[model samples]
Target: MGASQSDNAHLSKADVVSRIKTRLASADIKKAQEVGGIFLFNIIKGTTVYSWTLDLNKVEVFEGEPEDDPDTTFTLNEHYFKQLVYGKEDARTIMQAGRCSVTGDIMRAMKLEPYIKLN
Candidate 1:
């Protein structure tokens, strides 16, 4: 579903993480298995903080503190995070607008796009 859809506006951080995990599981494993790295997502909603880690090597997801240093980290508010996951907003646009912050190896972040969405 698109991020702009009304229902998406009500999604919590956990909901978004679950959806992303589902999408990743159904993604093309061959494309991701050889691309091993860790991606960290730090999402903020009001006073709550949520963190998720994506491990490409094993196609695993951990919904808490990362076990190791992440190859790339993205920090953003919950709304923009959902927008990014659902394709309602592109990463570059949000990053350029200062709505999202990215750190670490950017190339690794680019490699994550295909695994992040079903569409």
Candidate 2:
């Protein structure tokens, strides 16, 4: 079984940022390093939102924008990303639905999604 709806629903912006940081601290970021350049996400958590970044190799958390523009920026809600990570939804479809948006290098960003598993 997956995490409860409440688990998804009760998430706060900081909680969402923390989750991404914790997830990056795991093996996901190692996988992400193959594709260079940084990623920035504006995570929508209910009524609030926050930005976060993953230093793929460093596996460190950077709370604010980087000095350079990110290779891509993913804007979406926590629930939608949870679905992507859990394999409940395809990344392409999500992007098509307008639930996902990207900027900068499109091909590289598209390639990066496969490595972003939730667990």
Best-fitting candidate, scored by TM-score: 1
**Candidate 2, lDDT over the whole model:** 0.68
lDDT of 2 by residue, 29-109 (tens): 555666667777777768876777755545465777666677788888887877775567888899899998777777777
Model 1's TM-score against the true structure? 0.89
lDDT of 1 by residue, 1-119 (tens): 35447777787778778888888888778788888888998998888889999889789787986778888899999888878887788888898899988999887787777777523
- Candidate 2, superposed: residue stretches over 4 Å from native: 2-6, 28-31, 45-48
TM-score of each: 0.89, 0.69
Give candidate 1 misplaced runs (Cα > 4 Å).
Answer: 1-4
How does each model score on lDDT?
0.82, 0.68
